[model samples]
Target: MNQLSTRTSPDTPWRLASLALAMLLSSLGTSIANVALPTLAREFAASFQAVQWVVLAYLLAVTTALVVVGRLGDQFGRRRLMLAGIGVFVLGSALAAASGSLAWLMAARVVQGLGAAVMMALSMALVGDAVPKSQSGRAMGLLGTMSAVGTALGPSLGGGLVAAFGWPAIFLATAALGLVAFAFAARHLPADARTAAPASFDLPGAALLASALAAYALAMTLPHGTPGTLRLALLLLSLVLAGAFFAVEVRSPAPLLRFALFREPGIGAGFAMAALVNVVAMTTLVVGPFHLARALGLAPAAVGLVMTAGPAVAALLGVPAGRAVDRFGSRRVLRLGLASMAAGCVGFAALPFSLGVPAYVLPLVLTTAGFAIFQAANNTAVVTAVAPERRGLVSALLTLARNLGLVTGASAMGAVFLAATGAASLAAADAAAIAKGTHVAFAVGGLLVAIAFAMTLAPVRAAAAVQGERA
Candidate 1:
């Protein structure tokens, strides 16, 4: 077996490095385009709504195709699919950089997003394949750190590139990264050994699942002031499609999603905890800027600087968090991570609003650190719990859950803040109203984390109960 995880092969680190680059580039793709939206709008003379699709198209494409691409990796080969993904990403980036119209840019983004879907889904799966079981936590942590770095780097990097070279420079830079990743992958990534079992695809299930996911994402991300009717319709459409997909999946001989996997507590709980944690985690992004600017009276640049602290903390803690999982075990680390996040949430609610920026920064750092730990542990536990052949699908599910939570959080938590402020709009809210909203939003955030912590305890208790009965 050429499994890099079990050996000290010289290529191991290089192979992992390639995978890391893939992870970084995909995450960079996600956030980089966001900063370019205003530039795109001005350049194309398009409305904010039209330019927004440049970002939305990439995200929707990634969300929709994650599962399908992961399954394809398993059916074909991770290395092969990974190489193709890098190539496609490079191609898309080049196309985007050279785009002449708004429509062309959005289309390019879709192609980029498709490649990103494959890369994001497979990177973690490849971690399981490339790294040893004992060290999977750290590997997952490294990937998580790169993801944070990429995300953190995006806005600042994009802004600089746009200013220096033009909007195209951003895409061109990503294309360059893609090339680096591809060279490493092509040279070092080992091929998968042939499986004796016949390979087949669940085409119908794939199509239905992709459609359902895209619908849900669009519904969740509808532009502000969009009619509630349209959102509701999208939601219903997603549900119906999801239901149909499941119905088809159950009857498929080679199902894209294996229902039986979720029967395992580790797999099922891992997925649920991921979504729950992210929902709470995402609130920081949704509400932090508003609170910082409105409640504390910080300038735009100051708010951006303060907001950068969260991802910075996450990036710094990523490796250590993973090491903790390796040393103390994922379950212990999971509990600790959740507890920290819960406490941070409580701090937001408990601390006096008069404490100003310190109050916010302290709790934000703590919460972000906790999130880094939880993410590493959660991903490691879930990916390791699944069978090797199934890791690709499971990894995709894990990411899919996290993305769904972010989408849900952006819409739901934004409403939670707005409602708590007792104001109709952000501009109308006073400092007192902003303070009240922060307290309510984070209190709810803390409560949600508490729920996740409890969820983790359930399986352990159930196992103990079974053991006691056996005795």
Candidate 2:
């Protein structure tokens, strides 16, 4: 395999800024669209299940395409892939804004997801490519901060836009941001030098992986009332397809995802930690708004404000956390982060027994801060673990783990909430029932975070041992 050369030096600030802007736009688009779901449902006279495809389609498309697109970036050029992705994403946003029907909107979202996948896969890789290893933790922290800001602003911005203008305005705004990002990226991002190795795209491996991911996403997205047998079948199919994907990858000379990457010390653990943190943190994204609206009687704007607390705190802490990781090492920072997150989850689970709305904010802030610390350190660790040439692939794996966790965690926690409340839908539940359901979901999330906290110990010890021997 041949290595590619980057046009920009590792110390250039322009490269980091451009990459950060692109990441913010991509993440902002997802969160903004989520805020428009109910409005879209009302405007199209569609069922909740149908309107949900707007989000689901995007996620499915992105998740399925991540690995393949990442591999393509490594083979071609990361900058080239990023520019193309931004162009496609802008186009998709324009189409979504002009959509005439629910079906058209969902299809456009799938396009957006594809473009987002390309951007997501390459953003961190590009950062790693441009920044020195010693400074990577801080770079990852800054990038993570941009992501948090996007997420933080999404609900409030989307809600205001929807209330004042319409749902279409949300997409239009995103498109306008994309255009700005495109201009910045084009001017600032350096071109990648091509490798001398033969270019081989793993078509079969891509297909199998896509099938497995799509099957699993579909299974999870099915309506709560759907037949158990059908869901079972889809799950089984997903497992089979996943098995097939591994088989294909092992035989292929140039695989979409290299299995050997996982064998690197702490790489697999980093992926697991990524997934687990998202699983614990994303509960707010999926369940918090409904709890606020139905149980707490907060309007959309108020709910957005309340929900913004977590991301806001995360964004504020991100840069500092990165610097901490750079100074203290990833293992120590990671353990501290995991512990903070678990404690936050415990507090979040007990919100129903607390005084009022303000009580909820503290736990969210703590959890978000923990997320920032963990992500910055873990991302740096993952990027540094792999060879520079394979950064794109490792970045995609990290993203895949997070997306998988988002989908699975949202589905599982939603189910738990529904079952606990015994309500067909959260919107239909009374305050008491919603409170009960929220407690159950948060309790489950807390438990999962605790498990993740425990899991961090082994990897931390292993890393310490390696450093000791080297020393």
Candidate 3:
């Protein structure tokens, strides 16, 4: 019998680097915006809700487009879509830098979000298209690690840029990075792989999915004091829409998500784990910083610095975590990661308002470490779960799941904190109330991690078995 080896070539390293660069920019837009927000508020003399729209608009665009663009790439060409996305992103950043009005800035942010969505969805998809199946996990892990690095660095970088040169600098920096990444990607990345099956755009499925997500996001954003009956009606209506969307997706000849892919235990479990982990990680990331800074009277830069600790730990541990996944099993790493995350959440929750910065930093480190390991293993599992031919779609679906969790977590946690702190009264900002709210948010976040842990141990066992059989 002939032997076939599965390994990436030396020349392929540049492609991986390009993928990392692309991933970093995609992530940078998300986290960096958080740092620029305070400056944006003061510069525009905007209300809190107006400044928040800067964040919300970017997320809405990215979340809505991530999966849809991925499917389009699969139908057309991955590299082609990536190039277009990058161009659009750079243009948006430039416009963002020049904007005098908050409305214009938000519009530019939406454009940038669309570009980011394409970059994020296609970068990993391209990696899957290029790398051998045996080495896919390592490649995906590296991409995830790069994303973690972007998340870690974004706060500090954004804050520094804002402090030094004002809010426009952040967008300028992003534009420069995007251009550099685009150059590298164009030079180093290979042509997109061909598909044997007939490919066509799934417009109906895409519209349905986008509408469902939009409705759900709107539902979550509605005011707490909204009439109870109206809220109930909206929730029920949203659920019905969700059901209709899922049915349409599953029945469509060219579904955005190949529902059958989840028939494989590994693929399904990996996606679920991805969603839960992101939900947990981001819930803390969003609420913790705001509570510490605006509510607790800490400096914005200090909050950013403190927030950097967790992601920095994750970035440092990423490669090692990937190696561990390859050596041991995803189940073990995932379980341990979730356990550590849960522990950190518990520790964070127990912290009182009087707790000092040093006390918070320690548990934050623990949380970051857990996030690093879980992300690496979870991503590795997703890449390895599918065959090479289907990796693009699978990667897109996984990325979509994670981003969806981010959008959901951000809104949910914000609402919880707002409710707890009585929306932070005009003058006081309510540190004690926010701290109490943060405790509740952290506990909920911990529950998410714990659920992921349990799912990994149980359902994922069968998934591992399936992967082994395929191997």
| Candidate that scores best on lDDT | 1
Residue 315's lDDT within candidate 3 is 78
Instruction: Give a tens-digit lDDT track for model 3, residues 1-471.
Output: 101115666657788888889999988888888877777888899876678888778877887787788778777778988989998999999999999999999999999999998988888777665566556556667877888888767877998898999889999999999999999989887776665764667777788777776666655555445566775676677677778878887777777777777777767777887888787777767777766685567887788667777777877887788778877777677777888888888877887767677657766778878878887778777766666556556777888789767756766776665666665542355667777777777878788877777776656456457665322
lDDT of each residue in 1-471, candidate 2, tens digit only: 222132436536877888898889888877888778899989999988889888888888889888888888888888888999999999999999999999999999999988889888899998766665666788889989998898778877998999999999999998999998899888877668667874688999999998998999888778677898998899999999999999998998878887877766788878887888898787877778877777778888798778878888889888899889889888778878887887787777786633567657777777888889999988987877777678887898899998888888888888888898988776678888987887888889888778777776776567668775221
Please list all clashing residue pairs in model 3, or write none if there are none.
none
TM-score of each: 0.97, 0.91, 0.86
Top of the candidates by TM-score = 1
**Candidates sorted by TM-score, descending order?**
1, 2, 3
Angstrom error at residue 82, model 2: 1.0
Cα RMSD of predicted structure 2: 3.0
Enumerate clash totals for all models, in the order shown. 0, 0, 0
Worst 10 contiguous positions by lDDT, candidate 3: 1-10
**Residue ranges of candidate 3 with Cα displaced over 4 Å:** 1-5, 38-45, 132-135, 162-166, 221-237, 290-301, 350-355, 414-436, 460-471
